[model samples]
Target: MYDRKDPYYKKAKQEGYKSRAAYKLKEIDKKYNLYHQNSRVLDAGCAPGGWSQVLLERVKNGVVVGVDILEMDSLNHPAFHFIHGDITEDETVERILEISDKYDLVVSDAAPNTSGQKLLDHVNSVELVQKIAELTRKVLKKKGTFLFKLFEGEDKDMVLKGLRKDFDMVKVVKPDATRKNSFEIYVICRGYKGEQG
Candidate 1:
């Protein structure tokens, strides 16, 4: 359970970010410089709009498109578009493709619904990662970047191995904003080598 009293949580509330997860992307971007002026971004599993909010901050002149099964209240930014749908569905992927030609950056904070059983949760998480990988292949521009949130488990190495084949560079990172006890880690993939439009 996340401590509501945590300083990052407090800072998020004070600064009007929808969730403390905002800082994770901020820190990631600080290190990788993922966003650029007028850059197009796809935020998968964006709920309550925190990652989208951070993307908005970076892409003032660009577009930030978000999609998730959960309903997210509008961020009220001109550059932001929210799609309320399950990203695992073909319709949802089609919707995303319809709106943007290709994304310069694709970021997913998506996690499978936990079943309390660790192994089951890991399997489900890996399934979601596969879906996200397919989506990335279709929509991510060549040489684009993908930042994926993943749980450390037996299947993680397999996932990373496949990602290495798709991207020029693939590495794991645990941002400072992530809970130290959490198994969650971010996989940053750069130079997408997927088919171009």
Candidate 2:
């Protein structure tokens, strides 16, 4: 659990960010150069609008469309659109496309609720991440960027194997904002090459 007095939590409040998770993306983007000022971005599993909020500041005139099964307090920006639906559904993809044909970057900080059984939690996280990856295939532009979080497990290699064909480089990183006791790792994929025949 996040300590209310955690430095990041306090920092978030002072900085006007919706959640302390905002720092993770800020740190990741600084290292990876994830999105451009005029880029189109899709933020899946976005709620409370922290990552989406950061994207809004960074994208400038670009657009950020966030989707989640949980209702998000609407982001008050002309360039920000929220799709309140499960990203695994066809309807969500259709709604995302209605805003733009494709996105220049797709990011997901979303994770499945952990049940405390490490193996069970890891398996569930991988499955949810795979579904998000499928969404990336549908909405990401050629040569786009894909970033997401996953629970570390024995099956992570299999996930990486599938991504090798679709992206030029795939790497995993743990940001400082993540609780040190946490098992979550962020996968950063670049140079999307699209589906292999």
Candidate 3:
């Protein structure tokens, strides 16, 4: 019951992409130069595999590890690895850490399920962003990059403030592929300072 004929949706189908969300990442990377030829990447909330596909194309020789609670069809590339489980769990974190010591880039497209209550939804989104930030701290290498989506609300500013403490550059980005009516924006942080004194 969605509009399969939407221009982006149609373009995704033609290009063999798993979802139209791929274009969002494409635009972000185009503007930010987030990818390198050999960048170890971690993708959280990566169901349906669009973002992982983009990472695979861009990272070429580096590792791409994607994790989510939902099942995803295997991406089937030597450089690509998928884990099925909640990313917040210790077991999942261990599994990911076992594969790579640290990541050069961490990207999360995670979003909480909205209940149509604006205040409650915003609160939940803020919590989810905090969780992702914690995970990024644990897994990302020093001077790495992070790109995660956050819904606009009062807490958005607070989240940005927290991120600025650790990253040399923290920016808010709304890609062209984002819906005009949506409240979502991506927080891009680079030059991670790491979790040590």
Candidate 4:
């Protein structure tokens, strides 16, 4: 949990960002430069619009489409669009495709509602990440990038191996904004190799 007195928390509030999670993307982009002006981006599990705000600022002339199961209040950014639906649903995918044919970047910060059972949580998280990866293959442009959040566990190796088959470079990254005690880490995959037959 972020302490209200912490510098990051204060900075986020002062800067008008909805949440400190915005810094995670900032740090990742500092390393990967994932967003480009006019790039098309898909943000999965976007809620409260923190990451979407950062994406909007980075992709000046670009478009950002964010999807989440929960309703989000209006973001008021011309470049940003939000869809309220389950990303795993076919209807959601169809809606996303209607906005753009190929996306340059796909970012997922999704996590299953935890049951407080460690093993079960890890398994569920990995499964969700895999589902996002599969969706990335279908929607991403050739050579697009995928960034997703994952929890470290025995199942992580399997997840990384599957990602290796789809991306030329796959790296596990832990941003400074991520809590040290948390098992959460972002999997950064660059250079999509096309759909698996």
Candidate 5:
């Protein structure tokens, strides 16, 4: 059984972190060595900015640009930047390109608004993951890392196969911080192979 009183939950409240999702990214970075002192990151679906906090702390001179559909209260961190918009939109992409330099990493935690249908939920999750993958290929620097959330389903193999074609290595990870009952998993892809024109 999962512990409701996990240390991360306690730490989040104590440290004023916006969400427990912060520990998920912390653990992912710790295990994969993703974030670095000088990294420039684009965070898609960053709303409350938990992951942005982690990135800000890890990267010494790093800059973090976050985008989400929801409005975020002003954040004053020197290394943190936020843009409110839909990442799937071309205008939003152009806006990101304007503010972003070379991206060392791209992290996405986007999820569809669930409709309570299991099959529909799975399909929506898969589509979001594919969309993130496509955007990563366009915006990420060569050898940049891409991390995004996905749910296990029939489309899992297809997603993995497509990822393999563009990434040197793609791994599915279930972080210890994630709930065991939850269908969510993270796809960590390293070394972008450059998108075809």
Candidate 6:
């Protein structure tokens, strides 16, 4: 039984965070030791700005550049930057590249609007993540990190095998904050060796 106001949702409201997704990022970072005080990050599909908020807090000096098709409410921090555009588009990628030569980390919580059919949803999610992976390769630094949300399905292993070629280590995680009924998982690709085109 998944409640609309689940524990994570209530905690986000009480803690002044934008969404429950913030906790997912927090728990993943705690376990993985992904970021540092100066890690440049690219936040793809970063609307509502929850992950970007965590990035800004964790990486005190390095910049956080968030890009999305939908407009995001401003986060008024010195190192935080936002782009109102689709991350998959060349124009948006150009804008992002203009922001920084390379990013130490790239994260996305993007997903296609679900139609309630699980298999179709999973396929769409895989395609979306693959597109984001391409964008990650273009922007991420050679020893960079990549993390993104993915809906589980049969083809996920194919995705993992592909990522393994690009990253030295790749792991899929389901954070405690994630609802038990939700099929979504997060993929962490670390030590990017730039193995892909």
Clashes of each: 0, 0, 0, 0, 0, 0
Which candidate has the highest lDDT of all? 2
lDDT of 1 by residue, 124-161 (tens): 88999899988899999989999999877899999999
Model 5 worst lDDT run, 10 consecutive residues: 1-10
Which stretches of candidate 1 lie above 4 Å from their native place? none
Error of 5 at 197 (Å): 3.5
Error of 5 at 5 (Å): 4.9
CA displacement after TM-score superposition, residue 135 of candidate 6 (Å): 0.8
Better of 2 and 3 by lDDT: 2
| Model 1 local distance difference test score | 0.91
Local distance difference test scores for all models: 0.91, 0.92, 0.90, 0.90, 0.86, 0.90
Per-residue error for 113 in candidate 4, Å, reads: 1.2
lDDT by residue (tens digit), candidate 2, 42-118 = 99998989999999997888899999899878888989999999988888899999999989999999889889999
Better of 3 and 5 by TM-score: 3
Q: List the residue pairs that clash in candidate 4.
A: none
Residue 78's lDDT within candidate 1 is 92
Which residue pairs collide, candidate 2?
A: none
TM-score of 6: 0.95
What is the overall TM-score of model 5 with all chains considered together? 0.93
How would you encode candidate 4's per-residue C-alpha lDDT over 108-189 as one tens digit per residue?
A: 9988998778888899998888888878889998788999999778989899998898899999999999877788989999
Worst 10-residue lDDT window for candidate 1 reads 113-122
Q: What ranges in model 5 sit over 4 Å off?
A: 1-7
lDDT of 3 by residue, 1-197 (tens): 33686788898889988988899999999999997879999999998999898888868888999998899899999999888988778888888898898999999998888887778888998998898899889999999999999888999999999999999999999998887777889989999999966
lDDT of 3 at 140: 95
